[model samples]
Each structure stands twice: as C-alpha cells, then as structure tokens.
Target: MERKTKLALAKTATLLAAIPALVYANASGPDPGLTGVPNEAGTCAACHGSGTSSINTKGGSVTVALPNGNSYVPGQAQHLVVTVADPTAKRWGFQLTARVAAGTSTQAGGFKSTDSNTQGICSNSQLRTAQPNTSGTCAASVPLMYVEHTTSGTRLGTTGSVTYGFDWTPPSTDAGKITLYVAANAANGNNQDDTGDHVYTATYSLTAATAAAQPTISAVVNGATFAAGIEAGSWVTIQGKNLTTAASCDAGSPRPGCRTWSSSDFTNGTPTSLDNVSVSIGGKAAFVYYISPTQINVQAPDINAGDVAVTVTNGNGTSNSVTVTAADFAPGFFQTGRYAIATHQDGSLVAPASVIPGASPAARGETVILWGTGFGPVSPSVVAGQTSSQAIGSALAYASAPPNITIGGVTATTVGAALNPSALGLYQIAVTVPNGAQSGDQPIIANSAGKTSPANVLFSVR
Candidate 1:
C-alpha cells in the first residue's frame, strides 16, 4: 500500500508538471493572435492543425451583456458577462478584444480582472510586431485590449457552456462607437493537443451615450439604521437615479438576489470608484460599497462636524451637490431582519439559521460578540478607504457613557466594545449570555448616547 501511494503521488506530480505553464497559471489565453479577428490567422486550428479544425457558428456562440440597454456610459465601471456555449463540448477557452469602430483598432477604454479566472492584457500593434510568434501577438493594424480565459476558467464537462464575468471601465470621455471581437474554443476533454475542437468568432458594438442623464442624489442616510443623517466614518446610503447600471446588488456570494463580487473589488479603508461610481462628502471621496442605478452605498470618510457638500459621480459626470450634516455620535446597529450582527466567541455568527457548523442557538453562559456601525470614533483612528487584512487593535469612540446591551430583556455584562480592527467604521461588542435569557429567538437591543437600536431585529438563544 505504501509503495502504491508513492507511485500515485509521483504520477500526479508528473501530470501536473506536464501541463502547460499557461494552463497551470490560469492567467489568460495561450496567445491572442490566434483569435483570428485581429491577425486573420486561424484560432485553435493554428496548433490543433487544420485537418480536424471546424467552425461551429450554429452550435456555439459568444455574447457580451451590458446593463444599460446595450448602451454604455463613458468611464462607467460596468460588468461584462462573456458567455460561450456548446452542448457537447467538455472544455472551453476564449479571448476577447475591444477597439474603436470603423477606424484603427486602437485599444479603447480599459479592462480590469474582477476574479482570478480571467486577466486583462493591454498592448498596441507596434508592441505585437516586435514580439516573437511564440509569445502570441496582437494585430499591428490597431491597438487592442484583450480579456482571456485563465486555467481554472477552462471549465470541463459543464453540460452547456460557461460565462466569464469581469469589469470594463469605459474611457473617461466619449470615444464614439466601439467594437468588440471575441474568439472562443470548445474542445473535447481528452488531454491530447489534437483536433476534435471548434472555434467561433463574435463581434459586438456599443454606442457611447452623450445625452445620458447625470446621476442624482435624492437622500443620504445612516448606513446601519437607515435614519436621515450622516456621521464621519459611518456607512451611508445615497439614494438617487442613473447612479449605476444595475438596480440591486450584494457584495458577498451570488445567492439568488445577490451579486458575487470578487475579493479585489471591495477595499476596507480607502475610497474607490468601483463600478465607476463614487461619493464625495465635503469634497473627500468616501469608500464605496455597492452601486445600482437608483442607489449608492458607501462609508463616509472622516470629516469635521457640520453641513457638507455631498455629490455622486459616474464616469466624468458629477451630480448636483446636496447639503448634509455630521455629528459626533449616531450609533446604529447593522441587522438582518431583526437579528443584530452578533457572533459567538469562536467568531461564528449568531444567526437564526445554522449556516455554519454549530453557529446558531446561542446558549446561556457563552460569550458572544455583536457588530455594528456609526458607534462614533476609534482611539487609534483609521482612514476611510484603507484596507486592512489583519485585525486592528483600537477602542471605539463611545458616547458620554458606555453602551447598554440586553438579550431577551435580560441585562448582560459587557466584556468589551471596540472598533473591529479589520474593517472601517465597524464596531464590535463582547458580552456574556444572561442567565435568564430566553431559549428561542429574542430581541437584542443596544443603546449608546441616548439612541437605541431598531426593535425589529432578533437573535437566537438556546
């Protein structure tokens, strides 16, 4: 048995090493030149040979999906869904490039990798002309930007086909009409580099809208409590129209109504223009969370307490500035339904549903930590948009008195309340379960500086 195991390990290592470096890296396609549209050379047929080469226009196709009714706003950070379909194919690969329509193929706009499965490659015709044929080349006739499949993106055995999603930020200003050229390969799962594959080409056009309405700011409210007001370093939501292309989104996993965001999209501390949407409070950029056509969510940056100008910008256009006031403290707890964002001592969230192993049904005597936002300032202090991968060691800027916490009407002793180190404007409270706490779902309320949490949230106890 030991000898067999050793042999299996050796075989696996050898197989992995034998795979092409490009395949293992999962970066982009092997080469861009073979996409056929730019170089006019055959696609996968260049390597798999022409004898078995076949183009299946009917069986397989490539499509690009934009949110704005097929029209793109200048400098808008929008997600492009590239799909390649074939019912019988076991493996898939794709390469795509965008350039100005009619004129030279100079690369237009920009592409950013939203996930690890795809990467963006930018180059011009001059650069492609100098490179050796082995490295792959772009057309010298026009500059282009390519988005291609990585190793893991080469889905195997997926019944129909696969879709590659990434962010494409258009040019800051109008670039006239734009054209996209895509090449896709559908291959049999067999490991050999031979025939039994089909390659297809697709072209799409997008028109830049000059008359698009600028984003508007209807209301700005506390991110946690949804109250009409703002505070420094507090999460806030700006409600308006034409602010983004999509209507609704959640950053975590894509479950039903939620949209999955890549790990690289949301940074903790510093402000960013993800999706080409940004909110500036008192002239400072706030850390953006999610943006939809009607709403923009963000974390307010540090500022002095007073009326300030708040504006939302999409691409090169900025909305009319609105007046908003900031205060020293306006505590608001984050909630899902009526349950406060609390967790067990082990860091597993105390949710009504047991999503993680042994994470639900809070028991008496077990210490749990509650999470919130708009709890005021922190001792060590943090920037609005700076991202921290590790925990921060800082105390929360409390009201005149410490916060009062209760579970199911039973008073609980506070272990500690501090700013959650890893996230900005987030607060954490450690408390022990009360002896008389109810054994089912119960109300958990927290009060700080005279403001109380919403009564609709709940937490489970066992």
Candidate 2:
C-alpha cells in the first residue's frame, strides 16, 4: 500500500509539472509573455512558429518614441511610446528591455507602466513559482525585464495595430549610452496559437543631455504641507516652474542665504531679501533662505489680518501676484510626506530615512526642535523680516487656545515655542518625547482651537 501511494504521488507531481506547458500550448499566446531583456527573448518561434516571409518586412514594424528627445538627462523621467503597425493584424503584443550599450551589456535604468493593460516584469527574473514553460519564460533568473501587453490588453485589439505607453527613469549618472531591445508580435484576431503571427525586433539608442535651464516659481506653500495659508514669521516654500536649475541644495552649495542669515539682515524691520532672488508679501520683501530654479524657501513677512498679495522675482522674471490670508498663531511644522523637519539640540538634522552616518533617529525622552511657519503671535511682536542676534527677551504670544502637540499619540511637553532668531515667519518648537512613546516612526500633529494640521505627519522615535 505504501508503494502504491508513492507511485500515486509521483504521478500527481508529474501532472502538476506539466500544467504550465499545457496552458502555454493551448492558449493563443504564451501565458505571461516575457519582456525587457534585449536579444535574450529566446525566439518566439517556439510557439508562434516561423512564417513564410520575413516578419520584419511583412508591412509591419515597431517604433519606439521617447517623448523628451532622442537624448536623455540622467535621473530624468521620460515617457516612452511603443507602437506596432500592421494593416491586417488584429491583436498585438510587445517586449522591451533597456541595457548599457557597452561593457557587459547589463540592464540599465528602470521601467514603469502607467497603463493597466500593460504589465512590467523582469525577464526570466520576475516569475511566478508556477509559470508557463514558453520561450523567454520568467521562471529563471534572467538579467533583463520586459513590459508587455496583458491577455486583456491583447484582447482589446480589434484591427490595424496598438500602442503602449510607459515611463522610464534613467540612472542618476550617464551609463555611456542606453540601448533598448524590443520584440513585437502582430497576431491574427482568430485567437489561436498558430503560424498567423509576425514577430519583429529592433534596437534604439539614447545619449545623455547637457545643461537645461534656470529656475522658475509656481506656487508658494507653507513649509508644513499639512497647513494652509502662510502666516507672518512662518516657514514657507515657493514652488513653480524650474525652481532649481541644477542639483538640489546640498551641504557644499547649501541653499542660497540659508546659512548666512543674521539678525542684522532684517534690522530696522525691513523685509529680508537674498541677492539671488526676492519675494514680496504686501509689497514688503520677505526673508529668503533657499533658492532653486523651481522652488524658493522663504519666511513670510509680518502682515495684518487680511488678504495679502505675494510675488517672487528672479533674474528671469517676476511671477504674477498670488494672494493669501494672514492670521495669528497659525502653527505648522515643516515636514516631508513621512516625517517632520526636526533637529537635535546640537542643531544636527533629524533624518531617520537617511543612510548617512550622522543622520540618526530621535530617542525617547530626547528633546528635539521642529521648524515651521505660522505660529500666530509672539510676546514682543516684531515686524515682518525682523531679526535679532540675542535670544527672544520676552514671552511668546500663545494662541488663544494655544497649540497642543502629540507624538505617537502621547502628549509631549512643549519646552520652547518662539520665533526663529535668524528669520521671521519661521517658528521653532522644542518638544520632549514622553516615556511611554512608542519607537520607530511616530505620528505627530499640532492643533489650535478647531483647526488641525494635515494628517500623517511623523517623526522618528528610537
């Protein structure tokens, strides 16, 4: 009986192993077809069969169009369109791979599909444990990946040809040249695995691009994404076309005027403006911190409780006026999508996501300072763009209800809440992490009266 059971198990295993091949053979095309690896597609003739004439010359061809240009800028995303043309073809499919043109010819850049009909899979690398046994199967560890049409995508084809659109973000640094190896199939509408399909392969090349253009401003937003409206003494960011002409701000270049700001720059209650660019709120200059081609960091100038006009002027041109409301005690914290812009006592940044050595996470019980704009009022009210070298000599004008802050759902003590000494409109708040606070990333929020900040703000709690 044991021997009979073993034979039965072996027979069942054999049948299971044959299922993939059976599915591929019976289907109109190979199930889950391969894509993205250059010439390694292993000939479609394994299932589609070689036809009477050249598939490439059969009045059918595949063309790849890079929307930006034939050349590319490293780290830039380009929309790619692949179109197959055959007047008589009713169904269509395609596979594409990008690789270094020279050296080992390894894969380069990344591919993303925007269409629901197209699926992107690594060559033999992106495979299901149970994949169809067809040529270019993703069952093995193939170095390339492909983005091709799905069964539904193929079924959507009625006549002529079909086009697929996707996005490709290239590597940060140029990898000499990139070559895309593509294979496209024009199939008969009859829905059967036979000799009626034509397959064509082609190669396209792209080079690196040079310097582009300078910065431009689109909209100015509070540094804290969760908050609305810019307030006097609050951190605000101006975003628009071409904000950063080149690389984003870094330690070496720093953002223009960020590190050099001083109390005297805004002395006498004049608005602070950087030499590179100037922002005006209600006709008064605002304090400028960082400037990129497409974005500018600034402190909102002190303004009355009314609708205020704002504008940014750079070397290229002056932006159209954008009006915003001003109020007291509009508390907001500068934060990324996941974490607040916080710092340690030593002034080092708190960046839990950074892999850099000194970019450490905040620990429980530690005091960290968060920066943002729109902390309503302070005790010794100062004019917009005002600066002082000495620490604030008076108490802060706490909001009517004051702001309540919490970390990871635990109420944290606010140690300090005052205007930034170096720039107006930028407020600083120091909070101590509570003992019972959970570790890892913790959500943080500040509320004043009935106004609550945007949701999902976070900070790292080690």
Candidate 3:
C-alpha cells in the first residue's frame, strides 16, 4: 500500500509541473519589441507560426481604428482600438507601438491602458510593466513603450473578433508624422501549442494637423455707415478672416473684462498695433482701436485722397493688400438701422421709447446732440490717433466747414459741430429741432465738402 501511494504522488507532481508550460505559453501578453516595427523581432508569427504557414494565410485580418481619422494634434490624447478577426479562431491577442515616421526605431508618444483588457510595457533590453511617468513619458533608458492584451483580455472561447482599447498621447509638440505598428494573433483555442494560430500585422500613418491660417482682408469701409470709403483721421472698419490671433477690447469700449492692449503695445505714441495686430493704409500705420478675428476698428492715417492700399498683419502673417477709395471727407452718421444716433439734453437716447430701455422721441424746437464720423478735419489740427484736446477752445475742435444740416427737409440751425473732446475721429453736432419739422420719423442729412451722408438716416420727432 505504501509503494502504491508513493507512485500515485509521483504521477500527480509530474502532471502539475507540465500544466504551467501549456497554460502560460504567451499568456499575459507577449514580450516587448515584437510589434513588427523596424528594428524589432518580426511579429507574433515569430513564435505562433510553426515555420510552415505564411502570415495571414488562415484568412484573418488585423486593423486599428484611430481617433482623429488620419491626423493628430500635438499634445492631444487619442483613443485607439486594435481588432483581430477570424472565422475559425476562438481566441485573440494583439500588440502595438508608436514610432516617428522619419525614424521608425525612435519611439513617438506614450501609451496608457484605458481598461483591464490592456497593459503597458517599457522595453530597453527586456520588458517590464510600467505606467507613464508624471511627464507622460517613458524613462529615457527604456525608451520604447508597448501596449498589448492582458491574460483575461485574450477572451478565450470567443469567436469572430476581439478588440482592445487604449489611449495614446502624441508628443508635446508637432512631430511632423508618426507611424503605428501592430501585430495580432487568432488562435484556434486548442491551447496545446501555437501551431494552429494565425498571425496578422498592420501599420497606420498619421500626420500633424495643418497650421493656423494667415490674416485675410475682404473689405475696408467707414466705421459708422459701413460704406466703402475712408477719410483722413476717420474711423475705418476692416473686414476680414483671421484678422487677429485673439480678440481684444478697447479700454473704455462696451465689452468688459476682455484683454486689452497695455502701454507696452504703443511705440512712443498712440498704439498702432494691439497684441501684434496692426493695420496699414497707404503704407502708414493706422491706430488700432479694436481687434477681433473678423473685424478691426482703426483710425485711418492722414493719407492724401485717392486709391490706397490696406493690409492687416498679425502673428500668423500679413494679409493681402486691398485697394480702397480714400478721400478728404466721407461723411456718415452713427445710426441704428435708419435712425440717426442722438441724445437728448438730459443724455437719454432720442428714439421711440420702445427702441431702447430709456428712450423718448425728440420734440420740435428742442435741442439734441447728434454723433457721426468721417466729417473731414477739425481746426487747430488734431492728429489722427490722438484724442481731441479740450484746451483747443471750449468749442472743442470745430470742423473746417459747418455741414449743411436739414431735418424733415426744413433747414435746422446748427448750434455747433466739432470733434468730440474725449474720442478720436468722432464728431459731435448739436442742432435745434426745426419748428417747421413734421412729427414722426424725419429724414436728416449732413453734407460736408460735397460728400453727403447716407440719405436713409432718420430722426424721431413728436
């Protein structure tokens, strides 16, 4: 009985010793550096194929689905999936690596496991399980990083196909182009050996996304009327695409809490550029007031009347030159649709009460202040980019010639017309509502130096 028991124990130990060789053969993922990338040991076929069958000969395919189609943005994380499919296979496994396209042996980006189905390996001479360092990179000594399936990820007894998902973060800066190498195995699930398994390999190429576009100029027009003309010392609006790298707000403009140009943006005078965005009219730098991606407000430089070239320059590059008509006087009123912008003596807006939260129509024989732009030069010579000086006299920089003012086709007495003391390239005209003016919306017009304001402008009267 003792001899028989000893013989049974011996047989049991022998069987247990052989179990590991069969179950652990290539399980828990293969060794690193076997992705079939350049400088690596071929592919899974190096071990799975019995040296008789060619790779992918068993009618199976391996594929990788990239996150951003075929392009990758620098420093962006892309989720990737590798799939292995076969009609007869009941088990699957895969390994993948990313490398610079220019140097296939040089690692590109870093990988992280997004699920229990996958794990990361860092390889130099041998492979060791690793997580991306705090800087999202592998140690320099173990420069190569690989992602592959875990033991449970094999999905034994599964049919059709199996997939593994992971996340890869591209290099911090533009790496130009990158390539991903992948190898997969579709096993018949016999588990006896790797004899009946089929190996498949694939590669995917990715390119860096295109750079930001340069500035483009579409039109140059008067800031007030949006008409196609500019005058010396007048506010001009430039329409374009990519006019500035960022949106900028004027110090006292309506938009609040936005980035504005600091004193450093000026060059010994009024700022001609805001956040590296500048405009040029006839080769002279215009004072930049507001900047955005699609529009820019600037005070046109004192250029002679004729055709002038306009361009916008930003961090990306300079825009194409646009030709626009320039004149000494291109008069236009600041209006809301057809209504001329005006303020009552108490500073309330002169419009139908419904037009604004606090507005009332003008009464006949009442005085109102009108605002406009591009009304030609002012006396005592204020620079295009400089604010009008109050010391120039209490009148505050009167126009070279008083404009012809009419309300409802009856000539109204112009009390005063001058450049606004606090604003650049802005004009203020105070007039008395004519007693003969008809009630309701009345067409108001102003002409200076033979240039007429838009005739559609109206003023509300009661």
Provide TM-scores for the models. Answer: 0.48, 0.44, 0.54
Tens-digit lDDT track of model 1 for 112-219: 767766776645554352121212233445345677887778877765878898877777788888877777777676645555666667777889975567778888
1 versus 2: better lDDT goes to: 1
Rate residue 90 of model 1 by lDDT: 83
Better of 1 and 2 by TM-score: 1
Root-mean-square deviation of candidate 2? 19.3
Q: What is the C-alpha RMSD of each candidate to the true structure, in Å?
A: 21.6, 19.3, 18.1
Q: Output the number of the lDDT-best candidate.
A: 3
Off by over 4 Å in 1: 1-210, 245-269, 354-359, 387-401
lDDT of 1 at 270: 46
Candidate 2 regions with alpha-carbon error over 4 angstroms: 1-217, 224-227, 242-276, 314-317, 344-356, 388-402
What value of lDDT does candidate 2 attain over all alpha carbons? 0.66
By TM-score, the better pick of 1 and 3 is 3
Candidate structures ordered by TM-score, highest first: 3, 1, 2
Name the better of 1 and 3 by lDDT: 3
Over 4 Å off, model 3? 1-207, 247-267, 390-395
Query: Per-residue CA lDDT of candidate 3, range 1-462, in tens?
Result: 999999999999999997886467477777777788876777888778664256777788999998688888787788999989988888888899989999877888988888888888777744453443333477889888888888899999999999999899988788878999999888887774567888888889999985557899998999988886689999899998888775454555633212445566566778888778889999999998878778888899889999999999998779999999898888888988678999998998898887767888999999999999988878877878777773354447988887888888988888988899887889999999999999988899887888888778899998
- Alpha-carbon local distance difference test for all models: 0.69, 0.66, 0.83
